[model samples]
Target: MKRILAVLLVMALLMSCVSLAVAEEKKSLTVWIPQYQFSKAEDAISDQDFWDGVFDKFEEENNCEVKVEIVGWGVYGDTFFTSLLNEDGPDVVYVTDNYDLVKRDLLLGLDPYLTDEQKDNYILWSTAPENAAGEKVIVPMDDGVAIGYVNTDILAEAGYDELPLEWDAFIEAGKIIQEKTGKRAFLQNWGATSGTSALMLAFWPYYFQAGGKMLDENGQISINNEAGLKTVEFLKKLFDEGIFDEDIVTESESVDKFANGEVAYIVADLNKGNTTFTPAGVNWQYVFSLKGDAGFGARTATDSFAVNKKTLERGNDELAVKALVYITSGEVMDAFHSQIFYLPPYTKDASFVKDEALYALTSAHSDAIYVVEEFEAKKSFEDTLLANIQDMFQGNLTPQEVLDETMEYYNTQLKEE
Candidate 1:
C-alpha cells in the first residue's frame, strides 16, 4: 500500500512539472490594424507579406513572435468593442480616438516609454491632452486633411479653369457646373453608413469657415451659437438650390460619383486624390480649404497607434511598446506613407515625395489646418450631430432646430455617461 501511494505522488509531480513548462512558454503578441488605405497593388507584395518581414525583424530583436490581423472598416469597430469585454483584445491596435478607452483605463500610458526628444521630433498634433491622467496615450501615425476635389475636365466644361477659394465664389462655380453639365455640383455623405469621424470631417469644416468654435470659454458645447446656425443654413441652401446632392442622405457614393464624372466636386480625405482619382484616370486637383469667416479653417486628422492595457497582464508591456515605437519611427513611416502616397508623418519625409509640386501644395496649407479635440465625449457628440444634420437635410428640422437638438442631446449624453 505504501508503494502504491509513492507511485501516485510521482505521477502527480510529473504532471505538475509539465504544466509549469507550458505556462512558461512565450506567447505570441497580437496586433490589429484596420484597412486605412491602399498600400499596394494586386501584383505587388501583399500587406501580410510586408508585415511578416517586419515582424520577423522585431521578433529577432525582442525574442518574441507577433501575430497581426488586418481588418476592414466594417468589422473593425464591432471587433474592438467586443474584444474590450473580454481578454481577446490586441496588444497594439490602431485608433482614431483613444479618449474613450482612456476613460475606461484600458490603455497603457506611453509617456514612460517615449523620450522627450522623440515626442518633439514628430508632429504629435492635438492628441496630448486626451488622457485625464496627463500621460501620453498614442503615437501619431500619419497626417490627413479634409480637402475639396474638383474634376478638372468638368471644371473646364463649366468655363472655370480653377476652383474658387472663397465660399461665395465656390457656390457660383457649383451652380454653373450644375447648369452646364447636368451633373451634381457637389456631394456630401451623411448616411448612416458613414463613420462618425467621416461625418464630422464632412460637416465641421463648414462651421469653421462660418467662424465657429466648438467650445466657449467655460469648455462647454457652444455649437448652437451663430456659427453653428450659419453652417446648417449654408448646407440647407446647397440642398435647396440643387448644388449639394439631395440624395447624399441615402447614398454614400460621393467618391464613386466623382470618379465616374457624375459629380463635379467632393470633399474627402486628401489621400483619395491618389487612391481613387489618379488611378481612375480622372483629371483632378485639390482645394485645401475655402476662406471662411475665421480666416481659413480646414479639419485635419491624425490617427494613432496605442498599446492595450491587457498587454501588461501577459508581462510583455515593454515589448509591446517597443514594437509600437519601431512601427512609428520615421524610417518605417517614410516607407509606409510612400506606398500609399499619403502625407508623411515626419516633416523631413516631405523630401521623399515623387511629386514635389503636389507635396508642397498639400504641406503649404498646414498652418490653416486644425484637428478636432479628442475629448472624452467626442464620439457621442459626433454621432448626435450627424443625426441632427441628416434631419435638417431632410427638411424635417430647421437649422436652428438641429443645433438646439444636438446640444441638448450632447448635454444629456454626457450626464448619463
Candidate 2:
C-alpha cells in the first residue's frame, strides 16, 4: 500500500511540472500598427512581406508567437490611449506626429532598456518631445516631407516650361493655366472647420518664403505678427484668384477635380508619390515648394515605434525593445521604403532610388524636410491657427479676424492647460 501511494504521488508531481513547461513554451505577444500600408492584404502580407517575415523571425529567435493588429492612422491615437488604460493590451504600439500629445500617460519610457549608444543610432528628431524627458518613448521608422506635384502636361498646355520659382510667379502661371484651360489651376483639400494638415503643408513653404517664423526659440507665438499676416494674405489671394477649386472645403471633391485633370497642380507628401500621379497615368513632375522670401523651408512629419510602459514593468520589456530596434534598423527601413515608396528616416545615401521624378524632388527639396526639433512648443497653437485659417477659407471670417480669434482661443487654452 505504501509503494502504490508513492507511485501515485510522483505521477501527480510529474504532471504538474509538464503543465508548467507547456505554459512557459507558449509565449506570445501583440503589436498594434497603422492601417496605411497594411490595409490591403497584398501590401500588408505579400508586397512588402518583410514585416510579417520579420515578426516571424523574431518569434523564431525568441521562441515566442507574435500577433499583429492593424489600426487606422486616424483612430490609432484614441485606440492606443484607451488600450493603455486597460491591464491587458498590446505589448508594443506605433505613433506618428501626434506622439508628443499622446505620450503624457499612454506610452512607456524605454530609458531603462536601451543603452546610450543604442539610442544614439536613431535620428534625434524622430524620437523627440516623447523622449524630451530623457525617457525614450518612440523610434522613427520612416521620414518624408510635403512636396508640390505639378502636372507638367497641364503647365505645358498653358504655355509654361516648368513651375514658377516664386509665389508670384506661381500665381501668374496658375492664372495663365486657368485662362488657357478654363479649369482650376490649383486643387487643394480645404474645408469650413479648420485647414487640413495637407493645406498647412502647402501654406508653410509660403510662410517661410515670406520670411515668417511659426514660433521663436522661447516658445512664444510669433505667427500672429506681420510676416505671418502676409502669409495669410497670400493664401487669401490664391483663393480670390479663382485658381483653386470652388469646393476648397471638401478634399474629396478637390481630389476628384485633380484626378480628372481639371486642376494643374496639387500638394502632396512622399507617400502620394506613387499613387497620385502614377495611378492617374498623368505626365507629372514634383517641385520643391517655391522659394519663400526667407529661403526655402519645409515641414516634415514622422511615424515611430513606441513600447507600452505597463508591459515593460511586468518584465517583458527586453523583447519589446529588441523588436523596436529591429523594425527601426536601416535594413528594415530601406526595405519598407522600397515597398511602401516613402522616404527613409535614417540619413543614408538614397542613390538607389531609381525613380527620376521622385529623386529630383527629394534632392531639391531635401532641405525642406524640417525635423520636429527645429520647432518649439506651439503645436497646439499651430492647430488653432490652422483651424481659424479654415474658417477664413469658408468665408465665415476675414484673414485678420481669423488671426485675432485664433490668438484669443489659443491664449484661453494656454491658461486652462
Candidate 3:
C-alpha cells in the first residue's frame, strides 16, 4: 500500500510539470500600424507610446505577449505579403486597404468572432469588406473618406470665400488661384501609387468622377471607354494650365508643397491632411465633392484590422479578436480619436463631429471599389493606370495613347490571371 501511494504521487507531479511547461511557451501577436503623418521615427511618440501602454492591459488579459510595430507606408505592402508567406504574425495588420490579403485567402474571416451585435454599435464608412463572401475578414478601424481641403486664407487672396462645390466652378476657382497667387490651384498624388494600390493616391477619384472603372461584369478590361477619354483630356488640360506642380512629381513632394503653404488646394483623406496642418495652425475648409458635368462622386476606403490565417491555424484567434475589440472599444477609441482624426470606430458611437463634418461632405460622392480580392487583377489594373498617368504627365503619350496601352496590358494580363 505504501509503494502504490508513492507511485500515484510521482505521476501527479509529472503531469503538473507538463502543464507548467506548456504554459511557459509564449505566443505573441504582432500588429502592423502604418506610420502617421510624421515621417521621422522620432516624431512618432504619440502613436508608439499610446499603443505600448494600451497593449499591457491586453497582454495581461490574454496571458500572451503583444508586439506593435510602426511600419512606413512605402514598403508596407511588400513586407506584409512576405510575412504572410512565412506564416508570420503581421498576424493582425491595420492597413488602408487589406482586400488583397482577403482575396488571396491569407486573412482569416473575422465574422465568427465579432458578432452582429458588435457591428450594430457603430456607423461604418464602408460596407464590410466588399467581396468577402460572408467572411467579414476586415474590421474597419476608421473611415478613409477623401475630402478636398481649401486653404480659405489662401483662397481669400483670390476673393473666394469658400471652395465651390460645383465641379466647373471649382475648376474656375482653382484657375483663378493659380493666376492670382502664382501658386498651383490644386494638387493630387500624380507621382506615386499608395503602396500596392494603383487607384489609391492616384488621380483615379477624378477619373471615377468622370465615370471610370477598372473591370466589367466578366472581369474584362473596361477603362478605355468614353468616360475614360474625358478624364485623360481633363487631366491634360490641368497639365497644360499648370494646375499641377510639374516640379512636384512625387507624392511626398506634393504633400510638402501643401504643408509649406506653397499651394492653395489639396485633396487627401481627412486623417492624412488635417493631422499635420491643424497642428501647424493652418486653417482650411473641406469640401466633399466638386461636381463635374457627369455629376459629383466621392471615394472611400477603410483602414481595417485584418487577421492572419496562421493566428487561427495556431488556435490563437480568440486572443487576436479580443485584443482588436478592446482597442476599438469606447475609452480606447476615444483616446485614439483624440490623437488622430481617422473618423470613428465601427463598434462604438463616437462624437467626432468635426471629423464627421468633413466626412459628411464626402458622403455625397459615391463609393467605388477600386481594389478587388483577385490579387493580380487588382494590382495589374491599378499599375496600368499609374504607368499610363505617368506617361501622360511626362508628355510622352497622349491621353488616348495612355488608355489604349493601359487597356492592352490590363486585358492581356487579367485574362492570364
Candidate 4:
C-alpha cells in the first residue's frame, strides 16, 4: 500500500508540470475595433460570438489567444488615443484613416506581411498602404460609395420620370418637386450629429463636382474660389426656394424621412439604402453625383486594418501582424461585409455580393469616385467647414463669406500644425 501511494503522488506531480509548460507556451494578442454596423438585438449573434467564430480556428492552430473588443463609435477615438498614449492595449485596430497615428509613429507598416498575390489581387486606393510617405500602414478591407437615393414615386408625382443628371436641371427638378408634390424636394443632414458622413455624402460630392480640390499647388487648403462658391451658392438656392427645409441644419432624420416617402431625394452612402428604404418599400433608384461645371465626382470611403506599434514593446509584433493578416484575409472580409453592409470587398477572392445589379450600377460610377485625401488637419478643417456651412444656411453668412471664413480657418490650422 505504501508503494502504490508513492507511485500515484509521482504521477500527479508530472501532470502538474505538464500543465504549467503548456500555459507558458501559449501567447495572447488584443484587437480593438469600433462597432461597425453590428446588430444589437437580443436574437442577433453577439459581437463576441461573431469574433470567436472568426478567430477560434486561428487560436487553436497557433496556440494563441486573440481578444477582440467592440467599442462604440462615440468613444472609440478618445479611448484608442488614450490607451495608445499609455503604451498599452490594442495589438491591432480597425482604421478608416491612419494619418494622425502614422504621423505620431504609433502604427506599424504592413508591407512585410503582404504577399505578392495580395498586392496583385486586392483593389486598393491609389495612395493606400503608402498614404503616409512610403510606409505601408493600412490593409484595405471594405469600400463604399456615396450615392443619391431618388424616391421614384415622388419623382413621378413631381412630373418627372427620372431624376436629372446635370446640376441646373437637378435644381429645376427640386423646384418642381415642391411645387407639384407639396413635399420637400431634397433632404440633407448638415448637423454635427451627422458628423463626417454628411460631408462625405452631400457636401464633398458637390464641391468635387464643381472641381473644388481641398488643397492648392503648395499643399495648403484653399476652398475660397470658384468651385467652393458655386457649390455653396447651389445649396443656398435650394434653401431660398424652399426646395429643402431650413431645419436640415439640425435634422438628423433625413434618411428616415426619405425612407418613409416624405422627401423626394436624399444623399446617402450606397450601403445604407437597403437597410431603411428597402424595408419601408420606398421605390428608389440611385443617381450618381450630378454633373457641374467641372464634371461629376463623388467620394468613396475605405476601411482597413492596421497594426499598433505597441505590439513591438509587448514582444508580440509578428504575432499581432499575423492576426491582422488573418482578420483581413479576403475570405474573412468577404464574409464580414456580407453579414453587415453591402460594401464591396477589396480582395478579389471574396465572392459574396448581395445585389449584383446594384453592384454593376455602382461600379459604373467608379471613375468619378475619389477617396478623401488625408492631411494633418483633416478633422479641424472638416469641422470648421461644416460650421461655416451651417451659418450660411441660417443666413448668418453669405455663400462667399462661408468660403472665405472656412478657407481662412483651414489655412491657419494647417500653418499651426
TM-scores of the candidates in the order shown: 0.86, 0.83, 0.81, 0.93
lDDT of 3 at 300: 58
Q: Give the best candidate by lDDT.
A: 4
Task: Report, for all candidates in order, the number of backbone clashes.
Answer: 0, 5, 2, 0
Name model 1 segments beyond 4 Å from true: 1-28, 37-40, 195-198, 217-220, 347-351, 413-417
Which residue pairs come into collision in candidate 2?
A: 190-248, 190-249, 191-249, 209-292, 209-293
lDDT of 3 by residue, 392-416 (tens): 8788899999889877876676545
Point to the candidate with the largest TM-score.
4
lDDT score for candidate 1 against the true structure: 0.74
Candidate 2 local lDDT, 333-398, one digit each (tens): 666666645564463422335366666666666656565442323455666766676678778778
Q: What is the lDDT of candidate 4?
A: 0.77
Candidate 3 residue 248 C-alpha distance from true site, Å: 5.7
lDDT of 4 by residue, 178-287 (tens): 88988888888886453465688768889899988876797666778899899999888878877767787987778888988999888787776777788789999877
Q: State the lDDT of candidate 1 residue by residue for 1-417, as single tens digits.
A: 999999999999999999888656755788877764565676655556666767887887776789988777775655775665478888988876655676777788888877777677667534454456778777777567688888899989989988886777778888988899888778877675644754656778888888887767875657888888888887788777777666768767788888988888888887788788888889988777776666667787657788888888878888888888777776666666666346645533323565465567667877767766555477667877787878787888999998888888777766344
Q: Model 3 Cα displacement at 236 (Å)?
A: 1.3
